[model samples]
Each structure stands twice: as structure tokens, then as C-alpha cells.
Target: MEQKHGTPIEWLMPLAFCTVFGWVVWHTPAFILDFGPENQQLAALYARLDVSPGLAPLFGGYGDIIDYGALLLSPLIFIGGVMTVRRAPMEFESWRAIDRVAVFIGRITMMLIVLLTSVMIYEVILRYVFEAPTLWANELSLWLAGFVFLLAGLYAMQQRSHIRIFLLYDAVPRWLQRVFDVVSTSLIVIFAAALIYGGYGEAFAKFMRWETFGTAFDPPIPATLKIMVLVIIALVAIQAVINLISDWNAVPVVHTAADDIDQDELERLKAAVGNEGVGELDVTRGAIQGNQSEHK
Candidate 1:
């Protein structure tokens, strides 16, 4: 399939970077405030600072200014996200505007997973081969993995690839299918709202304090993950609504056992071992035979 060239990166990068820069400043205020004051190695770095050694949480007295700055910068994330989706392939026919946001987040999370793997590999090599381990690598991996898990949900929802038993759905008529979609979307919205309503206060508190995981590496996993959970759930809910609207007019689909098959995987297997090897494989042969007869 041909790929769509979305928005130019020249524009997207600067817009996305605005949010990234603001997030860095807002989320890791200690970096600019009074970070690691107890570490002797960082003493020279601290001494050169124009600000005081022990100040408020986020830039001490300048917290209000930083807050306003971050608020102003946060909207750039949405703008960048929308623009980035111009390049995303509409994998499903029912794709909609909200799907762009989910796909954008999913792409970023996929990159984070790659970075997480590299971090783990680097840690393993250093720990076993060099007999030296870093304190930050493990925590960093955990942090990235958490966000990956959370963000992947939104992507999965957008793709309609989440766990679903389509046996009943496939048997239903168009009107019933629409009813099912509405019911499921409503449940998702309710669940997301309940979760956010219950957890918002705590998430906000942890985020404001930049709560850490309290370990040698001391990452802000608690603070960040809490906020991410609510954010991802809200996105998932929105994507569910979008799916309902976009798929409303879609013809009723009759899912089957063959629907579960991964065509790309079969092709890859054939390429890897040639057609003869694929034919000899008993595992997939039955499914292929069943699919052929079903299609006939």
C-alpha cells in the first residue's frame, strides 16, 4: 500500500518541541530549582546557579510563572498531535478525527518501547560484562514501560483490535449492532469518567509535588503514571465515541474464525520457509483450508 505523506516535519517538529520543552520545565522543575543538593558531585553545578539552593517545589517563588508558562504551552501538544496524524495510515475503514490523536500517541509510545529495550540491553551489558550497574536505568525502563502500557490502550481502542468476542456481534442485524456499539461506548465513557473523578485529586496532588518512587534512582513514577492513567482512559473513551460515530453506517460485518488469521504473518512464514514448507506445516494448514471452504 502507498503511504501518505502527512504534514511536513519542519512545521511539526517545532510545534511538538514547544510542548516537549514546556513539559520538561513543568514536570522536572527540580532540575531548574534545587535538584540533588545533597550530591557532592553536583555541588559545582549548584554553586554556579543564580537561584538559591533550597527553594520551592517548582522554581520556588517563580512557581506561578512556570505554571502559567506550562498552561500556555500545553495546547501545542494537541496541535502537533493533529498535524502528525496527517501521515498516519488509516488502518481501519472506520477511522475518524479522534483516531488521529490516538495514533499519534501510539506512535510515540512505540518509540518509547524501543528506547526501553535499549535501556535494558545497555543495563544488562554494563551489569554483567563490566560488573557495574547504573542506578537510573532500571527506574527509567519501568517509567517508560508504564506509559507504553497505558498509551497502547488508546491505540488498541482506535484500531478496534482490543479483546472482543465478535461471535454475538457478527450474528446481530444492523440496528442491533448499532445498539451494541452505543451500549459499549456508553460503558466505556462511564468507566473513564468514574476513574478520573475518583483519582483526579490524588493524581493532581502527586503531580504537583513531583512525587518520586523513593528509590536509588528516585524517578517520579507515581506522579507521572497516575496522571497518565487518567489521561489515557479519557483518550480511550473519546476514541470509543469516535468509533461509534464512524462505524454507524458501516455495513454489518459477519466475523468468522478466518477473521482472526494474520495474513501478513502467513505471508512472512511462506517467504521465510518457501511455499512448500508452508504447505507442510500442519498448524496453519487446517485454518487455511477452513478459510478457503468458508469463502467458497
Candidate 2:
């Protein structure tokens, strides 16, 4: 089966969602003032909290909604993007150890962020509407989000989706590309290994301390789970390194024989022909002959 590369839109969806979610979270107070003052649920909560009148306007009922909505949507978007890419025709290529590790870390982080954001959004909404919320949600979201941020490097490595100038890279000899791949992958592996070692201690310490959110919904969810994400990230980072090594020593492979033509070139061809889909060259010949006879 051919692996399908994700369309730009698919890749961008999670990014777009994260940006919007971040914006909403960052500006929750402002949004409340502008659009949510009329929400009775929010007003009542504000009143009960003994919040001053000046500050009351800053609280919005939709804070949870926005927060949770972003969280919920993020993972779905990520999953969708991954599945889309997975379906693309897979092409084997050589990669640097650093590059593979980076891609792996990047993928894991992306998934974690999306999932954590979703969990946060869910907890916030449940708390506001039902007068109850899950302790697990908060802790889960925090741990998951933390891992997501940490795993970014590994994911980037595995996917080989890191940003590069394809035009320049493509122009280079295959042997050189292989060399660059080795150098890049080696650096990534070293960096990720260091992060894993340092991160492990911090994660273990937190677990031992028995950290809790200190909210009504607080639960004794182990900090180890959060730390485990880093461990997994480390593994992914290593895997990426292995992948890079494998690719580095192998010859570069190209799956398709066709040239990649840009939209501009396609459009230029259309313009020259005056209309799109003129069909075979034989069809053009027939049309020209028909026009010539009509003139005669």
C-alpha cells in the first residue's frame, strides 16, 4: 500500500486549533468582558465567589467551553492528520539520526498537546455545568500536555516532516544528502538522550512528592504517568535515531518517476490553451483542422 502524505490543510488543522485555543485561553478575561457579561451562569458563579464587581465582568462562563473545546478538538485534529498521512504511499528514504529523532519527538508532542488540551476543555465544561468536575481530568490534562510539549523533538524525527528547502535538497547529490542526514540525526539523538536523562529525575521527584491539583476534583493520579510520557518520548527519540542510521547508510530512494509540477505551471498551460482540459494532442490537431476548414 502506498503511504499518503498529508495535505497541507490536514497538517495545519491542529496548528490552527492550537493557535485559536491559546488565544482564547490567553484572553479569557477580555472575551468575558466583551461577549459573555450577559451569561447568567457566569454572573452567578462570579457573585458566589465574592469577586469584586470590577473583576466580575472579567469572568466568562465560556472560559471552560473555550478551554475544553480546544482541548477536545486538538487530539481529533491530530489523529485525523496522522491517519491521513498514514494512508499516503510510504516511501523509504535515508535519514540522519538527529532528524529521525526530531521527527519522532515532534509527533509525540503534537499528539500529547492535542489530547491534553482536549481533556482540559472537557473538565472545565463539566465543572461549570454539572457543578462537578473530575480530578483526573485536570491532572491528566497537565501530565498529557507536559509530555506533548516534551515529545515534539522525537515526533519531528520520526515523521521526517521537519522543514527543509526541498528545492535545494533535491538539487544536491544523493551522497551528500546522506551525509547531511547522518550529521543531523546524530545531533538530535545526543540532545534527546540528554533531555531524557535530566527529565527522568524531575518526573520521579514529582511522583514521590504525590502532587495534586488542590481542587475539589483532585485525585491521586501518580506523577509517574506524566513522567512516563518523557520515557516514551525518549524511546521514540531512540527509535528515530535507529531509523536515521538505517537510512544514512542506505541509498536514497525515489518512488515516483513523475516530475513535481507547481500550480503556476499548470495554470500557465491552461492559459496558453485558452481553456482547461483540451484533452489529447490529437484533439488539438482536430480542432485546428476544423477551424482552418471553416475559414476556407
Q: What is the TM-score of each candidate against the true structure?
A: 0.72, 0.41
lDDT of 1 by residue, 182-262 (tens): 999999999999999999999977765666777886777887899889988998898888888888888665555556567
Cα deviation of 251, candidate 1, in Å? 1.6
> lDDT of each prediction vs. the true structure?
0.69, 0.53
Measured with C-alpha atoms, the lDDT of residue 178 in candidate 2 is: 76
Write down the worst ten-residue block by lDDT for model 1: 41-50
What TM value does model 1 have? Answer: 0.72
